[model samples]
Target: MSAFFPALTAGADPGRTAVRCGADTLTYEGLARAAGALADRIAGAERVAVWATSGAHTVVAVVAALLAGVPAVPLNPRTGERELAHVLGDSTPSAVLAGPADALPAGLDGVPRIDVDLAPAGAGPVRTVPDAVRTGPGPVLLPAEPDDPEVPALVVYTSGTTGPPKGVVLSRRAVAASLDALAGAWSWTADDVLVHALPLFHVHGLVLGVLGPLRRGGELRHLGAFSVEGVTRELGAGGGTMLFGVPTMYHRLADALAGDPALAGALAGARLLVSGSAALPVHDHERITAATGRTVVERYGMTETLMNTSVLPDSGPRPGTVGVPLAGVGLRLVDDDGSVLGAYDGETVGEVQVRGPNLFSGYLGRPEATAAAFDGDWFRTGDMAVRDPDGAVRLVGRRATDLIKSGGYKIGAGEIENALLDHPGVREAAVTGEPDPDLGERIVAWVVPVDPGSPPTDAELAAHVAESLAPHKRPRVVRHLDALPRNDMGKILKKALPGAG
Candidate 1:
């Protein structure tokens, strides 16, 4: 509805802190000047690539791109050379933007590089910023209000867990729609200080974590790197009111809270704590809530969809469910046969389909894939979920990966994983299905036990699952592992697990 972000800075207090990353701080006035100066030089480029590292530079690059009305392509700093090359070839930006020479990651040999130095204003160590960047006039800034909301804002590449990563084209309208809806849904305001130590490459971290605070005229405190000490110190200082993190981050916090009463007391003072990227285990949720007197809310969305559903900020904590659809978002569960689901029974699992202004335009240069992604107007999310009577949605698992048909019964591996996590002896758990002669796909549990010397046996684990859930949902076999492989955002790479046969 309003200009994405740049306009918010115009009439606001100049001294208000807009961002804080590590030791760096950028006031709203400073951010506007930095982004405006950089945007001037690159205004003509249709697209630009940002070395999306977690810090001031990534924030500046993305904001400059938005101010210039050019699409910004965020490249994962940990992206492999092959994946990096594919994104470069597909998006074909005029230049790759990085913070400084040393801050840039490897793998950009052909593209022209542009550096923007965001050293705090009135600094002694400010020679790194080129003369052009310091004095050059910026291109025409985005209108006070959006002249064209449909204009492309970002070209975010997917994780490519299955195939080559595709560029997800997000429009200005979609980005604005999502952030505005979230601000309303969460009751976010300029007075709120958002804190997180998440990576800045994906939607969870960059779009919402970085851009969200900017649009809402709030202060963002980025940890640069996450640590229990950093979280406790920041929250204890009374600087942070809200937190955004993945399940793994919350898991670490939960463990820390168990040991530190001060940390629990600090967290108890925060207004809201939200978790995403993956389902937070019900056990961890209980542990944190018991200690902090606060439950972390979980939200659901994908790269193709900016933000869809979230646990209502006002509602009581419903661990394991991702809550209801956001304003203007349409959500429905569809059967395998494409039939609409009946009333909310809380047990019937079906695929999630959504449609709204928050949906991405399409995958860059992939018409067939884009066409296949949507069922008519609704985007086929491929994620499975069950809705409760009050419209809250509980994520089951991915259809291609996490759904296991065992002995004619459809099973969600997530439920089994939670059941396994509940075992006192189990510290970490992941559930998948392997081929079996008797059952269609036998349930296999991968666990990192609390006491490695005396871990839970397959029979013991199976009995534990059976006692909590149905007898048929027990893990048929158990595999021991030191740790489960996870991506930067804390999602388990189920495909990496062995014994697929």
Candidate 2:
């Protein structure tokens, strides 16, 4: 009864496409019937593990688990065997729902498997259950939904500083609040068709991308993969208005815009273009806007915090900022000494702390780690940020990797990285701090040169940084790499960089 979507589909056209992924598609009626059927099969299960993939089966499996009122633990399909096993041991799921378990990944052996039969969309008759829900005879009648707001809905596993990925338990209430707030922020509705090619394991893809549209009774067209052809094909096929992507996808889009007129026009025609997971470089933002006349809105979020801030759809783009704290989300900056700052002059940097309904209930099994993550009720996000007087929050970088202390001046690595990126010789850049006897921590620049045959020197990069930012913040050490190592979400793996402090 506390679910967000069942009632949303009421009075709406059941024949409408709820999800369309490649050749596979599902109507609203089909989604309800399929989910209700699977829900009945796993009625009393406490937890279910979904082998998250970009397919109709994975989407249906997750929806079925939610309908059954069970906490769903989404497993990253590409995760290593050891990491996958740790997740299974920590969050013992009653069943693992997947398309085909034939080539089962390592660590999933001996686990109960519920094969999700993905019927072609719109093929089956929508049979009605007793609770005004349409269900097929595939699994039987679903259990009556109980009105429990605090019920654990999702156990999204995120990697810990040490050991395996720690599961973050997000309650039903939290999910509901987050989706509703986002709807208001983005002017989302059922009439709009959302387009995205993001992965289904992380929150950006699963929680928001998959579930958000369903909750609002909107049509979603997933590209299955990110490609310029896919984006143009989907968006160009009328009614695809909203698009979601990370910085990498946007960067590719921006890079190709000059040569592709159809792509630029299709992007310009979109109602909204959103970028998240990592900061989109200012250069890319400016290039896309210059070509397409459409600015990509950036939002900030994490596995632990579903969504914190977003640049509104109507708000003109601010190159480097991720806008203000979303509705019902409280944000503050905490200095290194643990004192909360009162004013935002846009210069002082502090660790961002947030308290809101969107936050997770706790880290599963590790209660001490959960307690340590929060200061009272406010979650201490290790990201360093500087808020403008107008309430826009600009991320500096991670406290662990980007905050460099040198020459009695606390410097942020993101600004230096951006400055280095502005140089024509630099193809890619990441900034970190290495300990030095004179400066305590000297600023170091990791650069991917545009031309390896004639690369920029450490002195040239140092002068570039000095011209762009404060002289003290200039990089004293420059190391060139062929390319920067990035994670699945397109975030630079700072720890993976050599000589990181």
Candidate 3:
């Protein structure tokens, strides 16, 4: 039996709810039987793709693929034709598992289609794994011998910022390690019931939000779509103990808190509130915390590294930081000269590098890219950050986009964005570096003003940022916009900004 989900084999109540999406609810027994039955159908397949919708079908299909020891690649429902074609051509899965009613794009027409059945299991106690689908004991530690198979469990693709999205191969061991580490950090247990409305295509929503609960024998309540009303109903009903969301969701919540008392009350009742995929602006963080007395914790990770650092539930929230390295993960910062920085002064910014069992094995069919991604055992994250004396990490920005070397001083765009967000005139802000004859790279601020008709002047906004942060960190140029371009996960697409490379 696979050891990833112990709730099934732990002799727990069969009728306990495992996953709930809107009106659809699946008990532990039901999920086990459904997944095990489907696992039997594709036991020997090398790889499979799942049309990742925000629904129970996605959860069940992914669980089944993991049970059968086949790598599952989650395809975003909104992927464009060219990118979709690239992913399909790159991964080359034999079949595509999708919900019964999902209208898969023509790009997937060539692959054999397998409709995941979401029917309830027969009335009886269920075995977690049927004999036909059992894949050994499941998910061993890393550093497996060369002779070991080390089959990957998932092939999550990166957001094609640099090029066509590369398939990141995540082994079962890596997934299990990540979940276990998070369980320890958050004091997560079977008693907790999680609530979220995040899409199932990414690691934050699928791996940690869905699989994390299953690993800990907890319950998951997924909102089909993100709404403050949904959050209130789920968390206020006395069922949900935790909530997970991205900065965009939290930002909306912060905005609604002033008018919606129910939302504030519900958020206050939750035990843990987590934000990931991008940094939560300090302005929004302060607003939410002040209204609900619940500080939202932030965690840092990517497709290649499942999770590296997170703010523990017990630790008081640091508004701008993503806490410390998770258990079993080694985190360090390296300067431009490739020297590891020994200071935790929180001023010197360096490239964040991490080594841990929770990391993906490699990018599928891209050995050269994989080799370039690693410096020895440590994965070169390409994220720039600084460490506090207490070991908390504050991510400045991505190496390719966020770090701005201007006038002989290196700057991170996040602090400037946060400073701009602090201004009442600014509604949304994104910072980038553009080529400059004098500063090498000039700091540029793309802002969405609170009032479009009468926006703050560039000089005024620049002074606001300079007063809030530092003169050098202030935006050299400010561009007003209707909105910032964002991905499904609500991360700002900096490369899409004007004048960006």
Candidate 4:
């Protein structure tokens, strides 16, 4: 098989910027030299760990691991101690690659640290690997021998909702296939300079944000932190062509666009604006489109399966729908009784099961979980969705929490949440199902109001929801909060909400 990054060795424009974070920049030549040297040091390792900070060092370390043909485990930098300990114990990486300045947590005390060096070729001295951990041959600026496509590339851990986080082993082919499919979907090209401030540990930020640009031979400008001002500066100055963001980021931009013409102009100038990690609220999407005339393209995927479906750039914006399946991916909707649904009437809800080259190998060391995740060849996604006649996938909610079986109706929490968001008094909303004596499950709305002192009452909110949607879909109970709990990627943590019990 050919190399994952053909530009690194194919004598592309060496002077072009490959990756950058603030003042730190790495040209293709510099990246090849630095990552190549680091790859040589970790060549023989069974698995390596990357302290995935939102910086250039983390990118270099992961690229080095891939070049060395070693599977890399990306650990979130801000992970709590107990969870971090669990991940460290579960993955059992031989060495943890980190920036010299990063203060690693005590959970990783026993693991040997490999300091990633990003200094220019002649810029003073650089950090070297400890003699005890350096078992590979001398440094060489070349790809490792035997470019096997089946070799594991990354071991990304999933969020442990039910239990401890399981390691998802993504192979080299999966990563390449995902990026290539997304490229086709988005009309991505080397001329497109992608900009985002997504967290590096997750697939959205690391694999798609970082690796996608590399695979396309394009530039990546990562904001160390996300801010509307920073985003405006990058795109406004004509440096960035593509923008990748989650809903929260777009929500903030939508809120700010009214007063910031520069921000609006910058967004309007971008070739593509993509949103993932979570669904962008229709209110925010509409506000953004109204302000900048750019509809944010939303794509759907999970940790186990990479890029599965994306709204094609030419298809126009169809709010609330994640577009058709990508190339080489086989997707189907299965009913509760485990029978396949053939009709695409856009009303029937079913679990999404996908089989494709984009899927991960399995959960690392957990055959039971790996086995349970799949039914025959298709991987059961646990996500519930409906398909339009044109084959667009509209996710209603997750089967575990988002799907509310109440009064003999299968309602997706997302639509309820979207309806609640449309109300001017509501700022943030999360819909969930609570057990009820009368109804099988009661739809509960947890909301952060625009004005806490004069928040909307339960009756008013319920009436509002009933006005927009069906009467049965209205929230039976409404809980007001100052704010909603969210993960690093800006996804609302429904289980963490107060009164979740």
lDDT of 2 by residue, 118-204 (tens): 553334344434462433434334445647888888999885545568899998888888888889999998878899999999999
The alpha-carbon lDDT assigned to residue 314 of candidate 4 equals 84
Tell me the spans in candidate 2 whose CA falls farther than 4 Å from its real position: 7-10, 120-143
Once fitted onto the true fold, the runs of candidate 4 whose alpha carbons sit more than 4 angstroms away are 120-140
Query: Which window of 10 residues has the lowest lDDT sum in candidate 4?
Result: 124-133
Q: Model 1: runs farther than 4 Å from truth?
A: 6-8, 103-106, 119-146
- The residue pairs that clash in candidate 4, if any, are none
Identify the superior model by TM-score, candidate 2 or candidate 4.
4
Q: Name the lDDT value of residue 227 in candidate 4.
A: 96
Roughly what TM-score does model 4 have, to 2 decimal places? Answer: 0.95
Candidate 3 per-residue C-alpha lDDT over 1-501 given as tens digits, one digit per residue, 9 for 90 to 100: 446777665377778999998777999877877776677677778899999999999999998887777899999999999999999999999899998899999999999999898763344445543345433333211111112236688899999888889999999889889999998999999999999999998999999989999989899999999998999999998569999999999999999999999898999999999999999999888999999999999999999999999998778769999999999999999999999998899898999999989999999998999999998999999999999999999999998889999999889988898888889999999999888998898888999999999999889988998888788888888899999999899989988877677
Local lDDT at 334 for model 1: 94
Q: Give the top-scoring candidate (lDDT).
A: 4
Cα lDDT, model 2, residue 469: 81
